[model samples]
Target chain A: MNPCNHHSVSIKEMQKLCVSLVPIFNHLQPTEMEKIVHATRSASYQRGEQIYGAGDTSAQLFIVHRGLVKIFRLSESGREQLIRLLEPGDFMGELALFSGSPFDHFAVAMEQTELCVMTREDLNAFIEQHPKISLRIMEEFSRRLERAEKLISCLTSEATEQRIAAYLVELADEHAANSFTLPMSKKDIASYLGTTPETVSRKLAEFQENGWIEQSGQRNITLLDRYALQNL
Target chain B: MNPCNHHSVSIKEMQKLCVSLVPIFNHLQPTEMEKIVHATRSASYQRGEQIYGAGDTSAQLFIVHRGLVKIFRLSESGREQLIRLLEPGDFMGELALFSGSPFDHFAVAMEQTELCVMTREDLNAFIEQHPKISLRIMEEFSRRLERAEKLISCLTSEATEQRIAAYLVELADEHAANSFTLPMSKKDIASYLGTTPETVSRKLAEFQENGWIEQSGQRNITLLDRYALQNL
Candidate 1:
């Protein structure tokens, strides 16, 4: 499955779509955004495609324009830990943009996905020519760093249940609704939460039994009582 | 006792001294480096002086022009963990600069010290005007991030004794010249290693008994057998 084919959008349409979708480009003058949009190459990956893996040379920064991408690492025992999920408008590979080292994790397509790719060197050149754009990029980097630190702090300090609740609330916020499809499978969610799939299943069942949430299927989850869920 | 006073240098000269000492500034063009030197302020701190504490709003990026500084944090029980020690060219405050958060850890003067301080906002503005400068700064941040990720991996995978040995080798690589004094006390080292002071003492004794290392007084450690130490 290819997102480009599924969406049936032409390259020109995709370029326009890219400019409208990414907030980072919104701050730029239309001319500058057009230059970037013209430079960006759109690519599609099928579900489970390895977009890039750990130790891959840091070459391109990727912005997800459609579908989902999971950034993760494999433990020695072959257990996967998802560090972050990239959605539409979300960028990955900034770490590579700054560092010349190989990537530390793998980014896999969680669904048929469309991405706009830009080389780090070209991006740096663009930034050098546009100080205001550079500042905006720095601001974006700062926000990501803060989020990573907060996640680290939570991982070190919060209980498993609290972390799960926090994850659900975060998912809800991202989707901007009381209900949405789980973007990844339970196993992936477990890895992201640093727990077992069984634990995630058990917790979801408990939340349902407690009337905090309702599940219509394996993927569909609705916060039946958000206030109660929050308190939990 | 203040290092600046001990050296009989004026504040302006002290700041000039740091401009030449720090490697991160070495890449700057001579005129730009001179501008930075002129803008920086020099300050002195006595041993045990708190340069900045965890949770304090970070205002300045600090470079240790002379003497030593220790970046550390306190555990829940008030135990101090020395995270990193700064030598002449070393700097701190990048985390706060990029994250816009309070200092995540405290920096204390390990000895009477002279420091070069620049306002974070001023530095950010300077970087905005000079994207090349920003690139260099990002390079520095990348190095720190690499070190941090490596430390995290070691903590998660290595045994306690292996960690101690690895830490000693790291210190030796950075500071020791055949022999060098431990910058912080055993208690601080223990906390940094996530162990007790008694355990640190015991481990040192064990290393000495095993002919892996030799200790002279409580401060100087000599790696008698580097291969054996590495194997451990």
Candidate 2:
């Protein structure tokens, strides 16, 4: 499905949307934000479209304006190892902004997606002129490093059920609501947690039966007791 | 063993040493480096000393000048989830430099260690005055994030032996030599690779018997055939 065909937005509206969701630019003065908005271009991707791939020369920063994007690497055996899932207000392809290196993973649209992209050259120049913007970017990177470290810890020590529970808790916090929808399918969640779809299904069902969480549908989950879920 | 007692250096020498190892400082002009040198203080820790713990207020950035430091977190069952081991020229506690938050893991000396410490306020001020240094630090953080993501991929899709092979390849590349000493013990390697020491021991034996590598000691291995190991 071509999202742009169905829901078109003007260039000015696109710029405003881009400026509003990008955390680094949102805190800036109106003039500063306008400068960035002018530099950004909006693009759309169909579900399963590749935004970028491993070994590709990276020269743009992509901010999700709508829908979901999956960033992952393919293992030697052809299995997908999920690195991160970019939701609205989340950005990707940041390593290129500083390192000027080829991307080490592939980014694909998990659903029909719209994104605002700014060229690396432009962004770097702006950062040079505005050092505080660079500092804000650093804070974002620090948060990502912390999340990556936590995922590593989960993979190493936590059991499958515990990993799922922790992941749900993380999602709840990210969404700022105990009752929310899962962004990805159970199969994707299984891959993200380094397990199988069968296992993820079984675990979610077990949680439902145990009264720790209530599931209204396949994607809708409400945390009945966060403390108990955490203890798992 | 008291490394500082046995081999002492003056404050001037210590400051110069600290300035030399930190990548950001090394890139700055000598005068700028000197400013940082004056702000940093020298410290030492014995083997098995806890440098910091989870929930500890993080106020200083630590640059390892000598010996090894292990960053890890403990599960409720007391199982340790190893994060990363810091060697000479590598720094830690950087999240505090930007976020002003507590550390989420424990940092401990794996051996008699010497370090240079800079308070968060001083470092932030230095970064503000020298913006290029902030870019350099961003590059370092980017490299770390790349490594952590690769580790996550290894944990998910690689078998135990494959993971060991991949880690050895990484170590070889880092040292710029096919033959080098492993910085950590077998138990530590097991923890880092998400496996057991027994499994690590068995895998090394299989590799040795297959003529893929030569093990001189528990901590020294020569990669006899890089082509063969890469295919594993």
Candidate 3:
């Protein structure tokens, strides 16, 4: 699939869409946001497209204007471990820019995704000129570190059932409703929770049998017992 | 232990000692560094002292000038999962400063440790005044995030023996020598690698039997064949 063919977005359109979408630039004046937009190039990725994979040396920041991205790393045996998901307003590739190191993970678009990209030199210069951006970047990093640490705790401490239950509850909370669509595939969920697809499916079924959740097909899940899931 | 009693050093002496210790402040001019020192309080922790733990509301940054610190999270069943260790020139508690979230893990002094402490508000004000500090903070965050991601990959994808092999290789690389003392305990290493103490002990012995390593007690290990471990 041609990622660009899916959405032929203009530079001005992307600038207006992404300037306010990016957390760092949202606080700035329109003129200042325009200055940052000038440094970026608009791009799109089709669903399941390999946006960038391991060993990519490009130090360009990919800011999600729309759609989803899954960042993951693979084992020597070709087993995947999902790192984290990036939604609209989230960005990736900052680490490579700072460390001058090749990316050790892969990023894939989960849906038709729109992005604004800026090169390392340009983004570094932008942060230098507007120091507030650096503060925002630090805050973003702190948030990500906290999340990564939480995942470590989950992978090490929590059981498979609890992991799935917690994820469902989290999604319900995010939606502020009992019913919500799954954000990622079961395989991806299994990878995210450090389990296999069969284990994920088994635990999910057990949750359903216990009346903690209701499922219509694989994606639509409604939480019937939030308290139980939370306790789990 | 009284954090201050172990270090009765004068404020001037502490300022001089710590001005060159913290990574963020080391590059600043001596006068500028002294300005930051004035904003910090000098404190010390005895061996095994609990510096901070989960749910602690204090939002003060702790910068280690000497000795060691360990960061970990506890499972619901009271099992400890070591996150990472902190040593000289390392700092903690910045997450609270940025997110206003209580710490979700525990931090302890592994030895009698001297530190410089700065409250979140003070550090925020300092960063505002010295914007380059924000850049440095971003760089530090990038480094830590990269580490956290690597750990996630290790815990999810690698087997226990492989994990042990990788850790040994890492420690060797850090020391730039074939022989080095283990910076942490086997139990702690197990927690860090998401395994058990018995498994860690077994793996080390296996590596020894394979002629890949030589060991005297648990603390000292010499890599006889770095290539074998690297290939492991």
Candidate 4:
């Protein structure tokens, strides 16, 4: 996949695409979005391609234009923990722009993915010219911090079963339905939930036994009793 | 204690004070710092004062001008976890600024403290007017996020003993000395380390017994064997 072809689209069409997909960009004027769109360069990565590794220079901020990405770190024991999953419109590397530090986590393309990349210098310049955009970026960073805090709390306090249940609830809420397909494999989900695949499998079986959820296929999960699952 | 001494200080004085304290402000021209300092209002809090509670609307950004403050959250069982401690020149209330939501943690004065506060509206206006300042603010937020992530990783992976050792090492590093007084009490340390007071007491005693550290008093600790502690 090549992102250069995607960037060949008309600036107006790009602005429309950005506004339609990115919530923060939605409030921006078309002219402002056009400037941003023009400044951003698009790139594509194959599945398992390393978008950036831990300790890479924090030069640019990346927005997933399409496909999935996993941001994670490896423990001393070499176990991978997926800290976050990025879908289309989700932004990564903003933290690096602010800190001036190298990337702390490895970001890998979970699938062939398109990314809109903007250098920190250009983005900072744009933000300097448009303070409102800075405010939006700040808001986005704040939300991400809150979510990260919640994840930390869950990882520290919740049991494996509860973690799995919470993950399901979160997926359901984000997807806006009781039934949804898993974006990542079981192993990925297990790592994300801070447990093993066996534990995740057992928990899902328990949920099914309790009539809280129904597993139709490897990737498909249907919440039969959301309230019951919530209690868990 | 009330902060309304109403002793008006010149912007020049404010700039000088800020320059000596915050490294981020050190790079700014006197004129820039003067504008920022003039915008900030000074306030004081008595020891144990609730500067802000979790869920309180975030109206201002606070920079600790003097003394210590603790940021924390209470678990469902009423167990408090000290997320981080702030010293002079450190900033807080940023999480609220970006989220446009009530604070997620409670901030309390650990000692009689002075703070320089700028309303969120004023800060936003300042950032809009000076994009470079926005970049600095983003840098601060990024540093915070990095620290939070490291803390989370330690909490998830390290044992209680390892966590305590790590905390001591961190304290030593930050204070730039092997010997330092703990700003918070043993109970507070226990909460911060996600352990019990008894556990903290035992661990400290063990460290002392093993000649890794020495206790001069209840709060004063000296690292006697840095290598031993680091290896542990």
Candidate 5:
């Protein structure tokens, strides 16, 4: 599939659609929405392309328009700590936009990805005019904080297999099916779970051997015994 | 010190002061501020008393008017992972206030603590009338997310000693003095750093042996060689 294929939709219309889809901008006044639509620019990155990096001062508000983006930070010990994964309709770059600080982490395109971009100045002006947008932004931040805190607990306390099990259950629920494709590679999953890629592979193999799950391909996973995995 | 001794100041006056001092309510119009002031309530918790618990549905915005509060989560493994220590003027409970969801963690008073709180409904009303407050809330969320991400990196990748050193340096900077009392107990610090209390004690002893720090008592710490700690 050609990632760039947008059919008959014009780029301008697509940009407006992307902005409208973002939770922060939803239900805005027609004119208020127009201000955002006018300011947003559509951009795309190829798989493996770096979108932003640590210490980048000019961070703009980016709404993931399509595909996947990886957010990670390089630790002092020279290991990458996966911070978050942004899927379509998710937004990032708020830290810099809100605090006027440089990026503390990095963002890369995990696959062919499109983003609806807005300069900090433009977004700030829009936010200033719309309290609803500000409220939405707070809600997004609150949700992310809750998830981050959970991840902290998982990283500090849960064993490798338990964490992996928890992750699979979460994914199965997200996909609403027993069989689903992994959203990320094993290496990325390991970084996110605070384990090594080898450990993730070993744990998955063990799970398969115990009839807890089945792996058809590198990314396709089937939860054969989700109850067992959940209870693990 | 008598935690309840507020001289002759009335509770209403104190509540108004607390709300005004919060960054989110700062710079509000007189009438707008009056709405929040009318809705704000003052409450206190004794040392070791829980302010809220995980799964609590009636979460209200809590501003630490005085004393320390500990925010932590009990993981599936039954280990306590300290998420943050809230000092005076810090606020929490946004998870419920913004999204109307239950809290995923618990908060307890480390000392006799005073709080300025507003119910989610009342706070929502005030926020609807004040765009400035919403923007400030978004900014606060952004700041906390950045810190949370940093903590995730520290917990997952940093050595216990390095994390401890970073915490000490942070406290020194916060206090603006090389000699200051520890804000929280060693056990709490250990939990925050994902280590055991014994390890924390051993590491502090090692730091003193290396002339990097001096602990006069259980809580008083003098950063004799802060530069060394920074370079650790």
Candidate 6:
């Protein structure tokens, strides 16, 4: 797919559509929405491109307009920790936008991606005019915090296999299917689960051997025994 | 210290003072703060009292007027996972306040604690009247998300000793002193650091042995070699 394929849609229409896709804007007035649409810019990124990095001042919030993005941090040993894999309609860099601080992590395109971007100043001005947006932003932040707390618990206490199973279950539930293709590579999954790829591979093979799951290809996984997987 | 010693300060005065301590309320006009102050109520709890629990419907936001609170979750085996140790001026239950959902964790008073509480309905009404508070809330949440992300990295990758060292550095910085009394017990500290109390005890002893820190009695700790602790 051409990274520049976003040219097919008029930038105005694309921005409107992207902004509409965000739940925070769902309650916004048409005029308010239009202001956001006007402020938003669309950008395309090739796979493996760094959209933003740690220490960079976050001037804008980016919504995954199309394709995928990975939010992560580099550890002292230079190992990457995958914070999350964001899909289309998911937004990032709100921390910087809200606090006017530099980003603490890095974001990279996992595939040829298109992003809807709006400057912090523009968004803040809009929020000032429509303070209700702050409420929505708070709600979104609350949801993210709850998720992060849960992730912390899992990372600190859960076993590697249990964490992997929990992640798979989450993916299946999120995709609304018993089978789905992994959005990124197993290496990324390993990083996200705080285990090495070898452990992830061995764990998956063990699950397959135990008839807990079926791996069709490198990325395709079917939850044949989700209940048992949960018990693991 | 008597938990009920808050009696010296009139409830009305305490309420206004509590409202003022919240940074989000700093920008509010006196009349606005008055509304919050009028709606706020004070509650006291003995150490080990459960403030709120997982699955409880969150009906209010709590500000620690005095003493400490532990926000945590429980594993299947009933082991606690400390999410945060909130001190005076820190707050919790905002997730329920913003999202109107059940709490995903539990909160307990770590000591004789006094909390300033405002019901969700009252707080939401105040927010509507002064929506700019939401921006501050968003900024606070943004700060929390950043901390949570760092915690995820530490929980997932950092060794117990390293995590302990990092946490001590954070405490020293937060208290603005090299030596301070621990707000929570060593067991709670172990839970927060994702280790056993035995491990925590052993680590502290090791730190003392290495002349990296000095412990007085059980809780007071003085960082003798903060730089060396950082390198650990």
DockQ of each: 0.21, 0.60, 0.67, 0.41, 0.66, 0.63
How does model 2 score on DockQ?
0.60
Clashes by residue pair, model 6: none
**Candidate 5: what is its chain A TM-score?**
0.88
lDDT of each: 0.70, 0.80, 0.81, 0.77, 0.80, 0.80
lDDT of 2 by residue, B63-132 (tens): 8988899999998879888999898878888787668788889999989888877787777677667766
True contacts kept of each: 0.14, 0.56, 0.69, 0.29, 0.72, 0.64
Model 1 Cα lDDT, one tens digit per residue, A136-163:
5555655555465445444434455767
lDDT of 3 by residue, A1-232 (tens): 1334313556567566675356766566767766666777777788889988899887788889888999999888899889999988888988887777888999999898888787877776776667666667777888899888988888777777788888888899899999999888899888888778999888888889999888898799999999999887
Q: Give the TM-score (0 to 1) of chain B in model 1.
A: 0.83
Q: Give TM-scores for every candidate, taking all chains together and pairing residue i with residue i.
A: 0.71, 0.89, 0.91, 0.84, 0.89, 0.89
Model 3 residue A65 CA deviation in Å:
1.3
> Which numbered prediction scores highest in DockQ against the true structure?
3
Tell me which residue pairs clash in candidate 1: none
TM-score, model 6 to reference = 0.89
The segments of candidate 2 whose C-alpha lies over 4 angstroms from its true place after superposition are A1-15, A37-39, A175-177, B1-15
> Candidate 3 vs candidate 6: which has greater TM-score?
3
Q: What clash pairs does model 3 have?
A: none
Please identify model 6 stretches exceeding 4 Å from their true place: A1-11, A14-17, B1-17
Tell me how candidate 1 scores on lDDT.
0.70
* Runs of candidate 5 exceeding 4 Å displacement: A1-20, B1-20, B227-232
Per-residue error for B90 in candidate 1, Å, reads 4.1
In candidate 1, what are the lDDT values of residues B1-232, reduced to their tens digit?
1223233445456556675344665556555655665557677898889888888876567777888988766644455556668877777775576556788678888898878777766676666656766665555555555455445444434556877888788778877454667767888777666567898888889999998888998799887777776776
How much is A44 displaced in model 5, in angstroms? Answer: 2.6
